[model samples]
Target chain A: MQSLIPLMRSISGAVVLVLALSGNSVAEAPLGLGRAVEQTEIDAWDIDVRPDGKGLPAGQGTVAHGEQVYAQYCLSCHGEAGKGGINDQLVGRIPFDAFPFGSDPGKTKTVGNYWPYATTLFDYIRRAMPYSSPGVLSNEEVYSVTAYLLYLNRIVSQDTIIDADTLPTVRMPARDRFVIDDRTRTESFLRQ
Target chain B: MKNSVSRRIVVQRLVGLGGAAAAVPLIGAETKQSSAADHSMPEATARYLGSYPSELGGRSPHVELKRRPLADYASVTPLQDLSGTITPSDLHFERHHARIPDIDDSQHELLIHGMVERPLKFSVADLKRFPSVTRICFIECSGNLFTSATEHTTPQMLCGLTSQSEWTGVPLRTLFTEAGVKPKASWFLAEGGDAALMTRSIPLEKAMDDAFVAYAQNGEPVRPEQGFPCRLLLPGWEGNTNIKWLRRLELSDQPFMTREETSKYTDPLKNGTARQFSVVMDARSVITAPTYPARLERGWHEIQGLAWSGRGRIVRVDVSTNGGRRWHEATLQGPVLPKAHTRFTFPWKWDGRGAELMSRAVDETGYRQPTRKQLIKARGHGSVPYHLNPILAWIVQRDGQVLYRAEQWL
Candidate 1:
């Protein structure tokens, strides 16, 4: 009986360790099926670009070249020079101080008057654009469209060539107008 | 069908749009008149085949999801066509930004990297090997209601953006633990493999709470429109954020502020300030039975509809026959699941008079569904069309006619 005490204690200790770290392991899968994801695999699929320019790929485009690209691929849905069309109006001059939010339902939310980050426009156009074909835009074409739209919105000059470094730093006019959601704070007002 | 066609032929003969001969195919052509007068036996409809070869047959041809006309890829669930809480796997509402990708489940893989100790790649088979959980919940589009719908609108047309189903899958936290997430991670980006490659940033806390990667919805593999192979099911969150065709998850210290979050879903407020990441859906209910297009006669009418909340379970559902003047508690049919659509019933004696009927849902968190005025007051009059869960009313006139009170919001 005395000799079995150590064996019982060892058994209890092993059970405790297994219980503590069961499914969540570093090198092992409890069921053992999948393998490690390499950096190359991640780069192939992780195409999401952030506002801070962290994920913007290496590319360059001029506003002049962008006009040719926009006319050919983007003009029908986005309209002439991005005027109001079947889809959302993309071009509008931003009087940032006089921006309207609620009183006008018809207010055109342009890149200058609405979007907070210049990188967002590039990221969006690169990913989901032309209304039909997505992920077909070349990196240079994406940058060019980003440049052309920025120029149309009067956010940048006509000759501004947008690349990784220049596009991220372009300050959006309505950047200050966006705030972290305060719906929880205002939820009480819902009752009243 | 044959009887209806023959009856329609008799009726059409009086109208003169066409003769009875024109209505021959309207009913079963096989079940034609036996002699001169009529009276033919009902023909055999269809035989049970071994299996549907390619395209599955719609069991009930009447029940159908009404696709938005000439917009994007968007369709609303048939709420009036459905009864009870669980929405059929096929009838689930679809609001895809781009085309639904035809994902090969065997070739599909989810890559979890960025700010994790061990970047793990998981296959569908690997995920199934882990512990699984089943919960009945709803995935609702943030923009559920269109304020300008006409009087002919049915419950499906009104707010059919929401659908409930019993989702079975592995909790995301288990995967997060497997990946060994870093302590500094605050937000995680969920990316899909559709044509648009849709992506949304979710708070890590919310993902760890009850969020799961759902493989099967309502006992079968998740439908193509509702994300196939696997999709992230954030119970009660907006349908856009519950990304379909989920491909990758990247943990980060800050939100990615993607196009969907930045320029689109963000609500424009009264003060010229756009509200970002306004996530959880508030409590709301609609009386579907006595609503628009559904005629009601003066008598004891049992008002029935669905009430749901993203916050938690619905505690009480209050109903009003005479608009906001008088209110009564509705009998919430149990067992009411959390973050799910709960059915409610209220018996009311209609007096054959012009009146307005509305329903108010109060969730477990003491939040009552707001009135139109309250919603407008809270979110300016021209608030962007997202998360608009205002208490709705149906106008009933003395002539036994019902129409949606859609114009009042304007």
Candidate 2:
């Protein structure tokens, strides 16, 4: 009890000293300590749903609902019917040619033909979708939209359900096309 | 009397907060330094600024040069902390697949052999002997927009690959005349000696225009991260085109269709096709200061930002007070170099008005900076994200709070 009193007194004195120093500036503290992050505060910004379906939430939606969601949230930028707007086309068919260069004419490659994993679509959309409000969609909504985009790209049937289980299994046409970068001979020749 | 008591409590809290904030650097130092040995002046590096630590060769002394997510995969430039258009070469962000290799300039030679009338080899010295031209230009990476995401990506992603320099080098034309490039050769392969063995094929016409075999940046020899000894400087083109540590130039009838050109750099679009060979960076502008995570005071402040275009020079950069509703031309910092980042500034009288602000770049080519919407409209929403040079806006509240504005790209 005797030691406790001295410790408390010292802590209070330290706090008072700090209070005196910080009082000189107005543009110092923001949101106040009360509004400052609480120890138990959940970090909403750390949301990153991986392509392997790590952070996906559980919910259910149909292609019909996805069409509506796509129109409401995604269509303005991505375009209606997934044809594409000012942003990238989320849905498409047909594999890229041997000479798929810039997004020039006669070199159209899309999700159905190029992306190796269907889960990549779900992960990318959930994390960075609608362009304006990313990470704002529900899991079921994300699944439904993924299903709808797959259907539009001719990768999935219209009635197919897309969930964590089935997303990895959904085969993409250009899955095996990508290879790791190789610069061995190129570098050796340059050294000479 | 009760109000005064509450006010005193608030003042007490404020004082406590200020002291805590001030002590953050000290606490950070204790946490940031891993060892006691690190505390002493590295003994050898006292002549240099900051701790180059030998672990990371290129680092700035200023605390502001530090980027978030300090990792090997990529590093962001401290755009908000920088002042002039010319980014201190040391502060420039570096993203390489492998470690930088040291090349002996004495032994270094550029071989121009394939598809030419006369296969020629020019040593670093021989290449410099030709008529050399020095010009300031900006080199930006194709994937510079990764940081412009809604969740405030770091400056590394925003415009890390982009850098301005008064590169001194011999023009490709001068070299072409010596090598006697065949007319049938439409494209040329530029190969690098780095571990990634980076390679890219560029059109001969573009090469003949303004490309050069650069050997210097700013006033010094180029850094290893920048492809020292020799590097190709393709002004206004994607940074990848400016191959560092360049060694070979092989002329060909067609592009080698390297993996980088075919699979990596290409942008997939709505029509199920990809856009390739699109090298020129579109006009873009960003307010470096007062960006995310930076606070400001309410007063007369100078709005500063960087503007650039791949097609040509930045003629004017207009600032928007009420978002994009009202626009006024900002004064561009002098000696605006072509194909380089032109520093633009505007004096603003902030009455603590809660408003959204943005700047739009206008290039000499007369192509006005596009909004996210305009870019989407032209490129298609299905298009892959690359070369997205939209005007970035920052929302400011009366309390001097600034946040990246997630505007409508469409």
Candidate 3:
């Protein structure tokens, strides 16, 4: 059945072909084009971490260690304690009730005020960070940096140990503020 | 006095004989020497043989079309200087998070895995062997809107981040079919091979519909800036979602919620909610010619510009010579494919008085391009930094100078 799925998907009149094949009791056949990938190969490339922390590697990091990682890596571009310098600001928080980002140009969208998911920090820092160098951070380093940023944003305390289990549990302040796109191709320009 | 009278008589006779006789140098011997310097003697080109053709072709030295670099990471297309719909592959607008990575196509491979009936790894060669599809569509960044408008702003400087191309590649549906997607799989994560390893999550329905793995642009191998070996082409979606340098696809039940989708590309609204996954660019049009620094004369001129919509084809583009009081239907150039840039034109006779010119595009979906006021009213001030598709206005002054209206809201 799995082998026949490809042939059925490729052809427009697949229903008729499937009926004919079922009558003849013939075996299912695939196009036999690409080779099957191994789990190890998949694991090496699959670096995406989901909101539920599904793809997170088995590692733990503390805020104290995260501070060291921040000082070595993030201080120059992100400023002392993530106050901001040249690149994007990583710290600072707006009141959860106040969503002034839309009306005020002066409001800065920092990690604490804008990001909806804590898992995103781990995913982004792991895949692309340090601006000049990316994909160089170890899983521990990524977790530590993620902890440090979260700590600075006041989402987590210094005593907390961040791991795959605990990272997803940390609720971001802007989590509920995001809504799916609600645009439609109607004559009226008004957004609901 | 006698010599002057004789020359005048010769000039009169030459005038009587029309322009052909004037080139005969019948006045004096010095007339022959000065004739070499005459502006209308076919110049000096006919006197010498032209250069032979070379291995590669290039634009004429007289043509000075070029892409303007917006910053170190991005460069904008020269929209005002271009004609027709298809943007030249080299001059296409470029916006990369990191630098363009040099890739060897032979070594590149695409891996499709996770929740699939059969996880597969296919080389570039393998993907090309499958049936190929070609399409013409425009890829526009969500942040394509250039708000830093001034009187000196050109169309390129205003909104040049969008570009159209004829892409040729295998449809993603075919590859997914070969891999045999699981029934539970609803979304897939597209990851790039660049240093940034840029990633975006797309719904499976969109992948099955019009998405293709494009390897060629404008009948040539994709440019390095445009993801050289291969890239994903999601017709009508925002540019970033059509992940370039595509290397992997992981099927899943839910979206991975990548940084590009969550933190950066999302739009904030006045209602205290940020809109996520706002992919489609609404209908928009802009007058390119007789705009900004182009000194115009009071005679007949064709008002030309480009209009496009992500939802569908542009059905009508109305041009207004006066400030939105009266509008005339502009002629649309044929072969207007869906989600492609459509060229529109309207003839106008300028009376040397100050006038504002604007164009409004209506797509097949009946979505008319909104005015700046309408956009601001709906989205609120400073709320929408992305997906801004307001109709742009160009002011033509009494002194025959054209400038961008540069509204205060911008």
TM-scores for every predicted model: 0.85, 0.61, 0.88
Please give, for residues B281-379, the per-residue lDDT of candidate 1 as tens digits.
888998787777766777988888999999899999988888779998999999899899999999888888998888999888888898777777877
For each of the candidates, give the backbone clash count: 0, 34, 0
lDDT by residue (tens digit), candidate 2, A12-119: 999989988988533231211111122222223223233355445566657877888788888888788876587666666543423232234344456665566666
For candidate 3, the TM-score of chain A alone versus the native chain A is 0.80
Best by TM-score: 3
Q: Candidate 1: give its CA RMSD in angstroms.
A: 8.1
Model 3 over residues A1-192: C-alpha lDDT tens digits?
A: 899988877785777678787785442335678888889999989999999999999989888988998888878999999985788888998865477776665688888998999999999998888778987778898899899899999999988889999999999989888887877742255322
- Across B187-237, the per-residue lDDT of candidate 2 in tens digits comes to 887877665456777999988899998999887888888888989999988
Alpha carbon deviation, residue B198, candidate 3 (Å): 0.4
- What CAPRI class is candidate 1? acceptable
Interface RMSD of each: 2.5, 21.9, 3.2
Task: Look at candidate 1 and give me any clashing residue pairs.
Answer: none
Which scores greater on lDDT, model 1 or model 2?
1
